[model samples]
Target: MSALSLYALFTGRKPPSVKYKYYRKYFIIYAASMSSFAVHTVFICFFYVINIPILSVINVFSVSVWALALRENYYGRHSNAIFLACAEISIHAVLATAYLGWSSGFQFYLWPAACLATINPRLGVRLSSAIGFGCIVLFILLKTVVDDGLYNFDFRKYADFFYVFNGIIAGISLIFGICSIRVINERQEEKLTDLATKDELTNLFNRRYINSYLSEYEPDADLENRPYCIVLGDLDYFKKVNDTLGHYAGDDVLIDVSRYLKQRFRSSDVVCRWGGEEFLFLLKDTSLRQAHDLVEKICRDIPDNIHVCSSQRIRITMSFGIAASTGVSQHEQLIKVADENLYQAKKQGRNCVVSSEITG
Candidate 1:
């Protein structure tokens, strides 16, 4: 199966949307709970075989504690569930080390508890750090106070095996917790980048992102220094639409225009909303005549009936000004020339295309 499918199976579903604040926490806690349940179930059998009645009974209770934590997390009582898990792991580690001795390596489970304390966001950094430090102190106490096994059993001869087993499980738990934190951080970074670069309403490139693109753009040297064109477009009488029909209707009109522009342009071309009622388009590898023709066709083919609401439809038109990279290399120069042409189009009439080479 693919990695994405595996991730879905592990998390019990596809990743939740970024808007959900607690999704990452929920996933981490749920996975921990299930893993704890399975691990304790193994301990229950191991203790029974070794004839350690007290430890076996304790592990049976540990399995039930993990089950209860899982149910609490499912119901969104995340703080309570996390507390239960931390308390159980800490207690179990101390008890196991006291009985079997530190050579058995049960105290290593305390390290994962330290890591988890720091990961949980609801626990402030100071408190989490303190808890982590407490785990270290507890580990020292286990080493100094419990020098050897208390129970005289035949299984005590296999201390090395038990040590290796507990160490591996604790290491796996630590790796899992760290990987969960990494996934959450990467997802949050993606969400922040999208918010910075995209217009929320139009879902198109915003003015700031478009300017950055233009500033960094370079023409292909192998293509004989092919030129690009910039088109400045303004919706005619857009303010009048807002004055007559509410701002909501005006927003619907902008959304419709944005959708049309996105569909009409080539994938290589850049389309952006340059503030209220104005748009900017960058047509790569196009000449003056080609850019003019394209804009004229777009103006002619615009849909007349734009639906703003269930009962309302309106007709709208736009004016476009095109500037080709004939003598200029800088984006600022091209934009200034396009803006000047846009002014001329507004002066002559609305709903027309004006370029350096032709006017229509």
Candidate 2:
């Protein structure tokens, strides 16, 4: 399996994953630093065998990055931690290349730094690009100006081995970092989708989703005469609750009513918080009689009182109007028809269900 796929599988699907941008970035950088610490510790053993003291010093710098990651995590200053990590990696790359000669393959470290700086949305593209350019310039200058006398070990003797090793590590780091970016992007997309489709107050499907669903949903005409029904529901005396107990209590009532309505409807049914103190449902593959029966069941099942703040129990009721599309192609007309039935229900008396086919 590819490194990205393996890493994803190893991590598994963590639902409702870390959503905070700063915290997510912090986690990625912390993980990178920890991995660096492990890799550098392994290199420390290799350097000890070769008696390369400067390379040992570079490994110490990697340890320092780990320490800084811990400190930044403690302080909850995650952005600074990422910046410091990028700087740490860059400096280690420059110094290692300068002291051990470019053949030590230290220049490969710059790729991860560039990847981190580029992918992190918090960091500016132009600024990271400039930093990457500087690293490239620094590497070239080190190769040009640094003499062989400064080098402790001649890595050129095992250049192919060192090159392959460095390439594998660099490739792994780049792949892991890119996968992390993709994970964050996916989380953000999920979050945005929720915000766009969900009602802020009731946490039910909002008017936007309902409107979109109505426009897109096409049922098979051969199944039945009327394949769907739209039920319009409004809380009876909702304004009185708001005026008497305050809007907060009214909000509580709406949320409670939403829960009750959700339980009454089937999973295939589309239930939405249509507006303030109002809800809408689209019952799929339901006849007008079935729709009316479902709406009546909901009206009867909904509790008469909702307990809100300060243990104050407030009484409320809902009025329902249901209309089914009878061989009619237009869904918009069903909504209008349902709304009119709802008005008729209120006119007759609140806390009742009205349907054009059943009531009229």
lDDT (CA) for every model shown?
Answer: 0.81, 0.74
Kindly report which residue stretches of model 1 are placed more than 4 angstroms away from their true locations once superposed: 1-19, 41-49, 60-68, 71-80, 102-105, 133-148, 152-165, 218-226, 239-246, 304-313, 326-330, 357-360
Clashing pairs in 2: none
Model 2 root mean square deviation, Cα atoms: 7.6
TM-score of each: 0.76, 0.76
- Candidate 1 structure quality by residue, lDDT tens digits, 272-321: 99889999999988889999999999988775534455444455888999
- Candidate 1 local lDDT, residue 331: 75
Backbone clashes for every candidate come to 0, 0
**Mind giving the per-residue lDDT tens digits that candidate 2 earns over 1-360?**
456543532342221232455566656665676676677787777776778866787887777776676456434565666677778888877777677666667678788887666654457889877876776677677778873426745555765676577768877887887888899789999989999999988889999899988886744542355468889999888888898888887787788888878877899888999988889998988988988887887787665444555445555778999887766556677788899999999998888999974221
Model 2 segments more than 4 A misplaced:
1-21, 38-49, 69-77, 94-107, 130-165, 218-226, 304-314, 327-329, 357-360
How many backbone overlaps does candidate 2 show?
A: 0
Model 1: lDDT equals 0.81
RMSD of 1: 6.6
